[model samples]
Target: MKLDIIDLNLSYGSTKVLNGLNMQAKPEITALIGPNATGKSTLLKCVAGILKPTGHILLDGEEILDKRNKELREMISYLPQEIPDLTTLTVMEVVLLGRVNSLSWKVSEEEIDQAYGVLEDLGLDDLAPRPMTELSGGQQQMIYVAQSLVRNPSLLLMDEPTNNLDMQKQLEMFELIKGVTAEKEITTLMVLHDINLASRYADQIVVLRDGKVFCSGPAEEVINEDIIQEVYGVKSTVHFHQDGFPQIVPLCSVRCLPWQKRKDQGLAHQGSVDFGQQN
Candidate 1:
């Protein structure tokens, strides 16, 4: 499943969010990383067909921009950044809803089993009967992931799928995502804020800046200190793991030194004024 973006342009009212964006997503996990308002989320939304773009989005060389909603739903699964509160449904029921697009009128026993299998695979079997409203944010995140997987989509786009989880839960989420993606060979693209997490899990990384791609390639090629500072405006040291994955340790904001210089000059000016007054 090859996903290709060609001269993609998207706008919200008058402001352009994605400007001539181009990418070819591999069959493995690809991480979309950038600072705020750089179109990370917007790019996912455009590809998922939630927000229409003026350019082309192709799946396996077929144009997907003109596909019907049902057809698009069958090929792709998109999880938004904010998980809505499901007050009326249990965890199992919420996951079963993923099968709705493929189902006819009545739900089948095989579909029920499939949903249960997904929940159990993600270790959410214990919470199956529990109401979604009763679960923690991390627990709900797991359930939403289960819902996304139940559809068995060829393309999975997740927007910050691990927003509020603790460190351990975040690791678990990434492991589960990577496991399923590799096992199913799903073409997965996710918006991630943490550069280290993206480098660890992504087969390729795309960095966006000011509604355009700054640089994109394998983690080692794109996650250098210079690119990090250029894209994110932060001074970072990138180290490679023994397995050859990149890790980013942010030192400070690049603007921090300039701000400190201005502060010192202000103090010096005040001292000169005080000395003149004393004289």
Candidate 2:
């Protein structure tokens, strides 16, 4: 699936979140990166049809804004940032719920096989009978990822899919996502905070700043010291690996300098920083 967002706008009461946001996502991983509260998650929700925003969202040249929620849900699988309370549900049950749109009163053998197949692919088949509440946070996060994949969606939207995962697990999860996306030809839009990880895995990176697209391109062109300073207000060194992916080493925030120096440079009030806080 190819997704195109044109002049997208969203607001909450008096504050505007997304303003004339426009981007094109193809059948590959497109990582959205920005500072906190820059409408990264908000854009995901709008695309997922959870929040109605005034804009033109086209899926493969067709408008989806007028589509009903059920229609949209059937076409797109969205994994939200907040994990739901799966207190009594088993892993298999939760995963099967991903097919709720097609499930009958009695689940067919095909649905069961599909659910189990996704769990096995994710290496979570052993946890099928385990209660969700008993699993660790990382385990639960992977299970939700499986739930999103079980639907065989053409378009996948994931918000912070690596949350609560350890270093090794984070790598494993992204590997799975990249592999599945390519094999299935799914258009994936993921919100990620780790710029290096995004650069390494994503085919394209879209940087959001102040509710608009600051820059959009491959990691080689998009991940730079200038973009880091402007979008994140941080001073960083960008190093390129042999494969040409950029790795960011953040030194400090622009506001982390001495007060007098900041004043002299006239950057004291651009962003706040705590002297006692450690990066």
Top-scoring candidate (lDDT): 2
Q: Residue 158: error of model 2 in Å?
A: 0.1
Model 1 TM-score, 2 decimals: 0.90
What TM-score does prediction 2 earn? 0.90
Clashes of 1: 0
lDDT of 1 by residue, 24-57 (tens): 8968999999999999999998888888888899
lDDT of 2 at 126: 93
Candidate 1: give the clashing pairs.
none
TM-score, per-candidate, Cα-based: 0.90, 0.90
lDDT of each: 0.88, 0.92
Badly placed stretches (over 4 Å) of model 1 are 101-105, 256-262, 265-279
Clashes of 2: 0
Give lDDT: candidate 2, residue 5: 99
For residues 1-279, could you state the per-residue lDDT of candidate 2 as single tens digits? 999999999999989999999999999999999999999999999999888999899999999989998899878999999977875888888898898843345777998899899888777899999999899989999999999998889999999999999998899889989999999999999999999999999999999998999999999999999999999999999999999899999998887557768788887566777689687
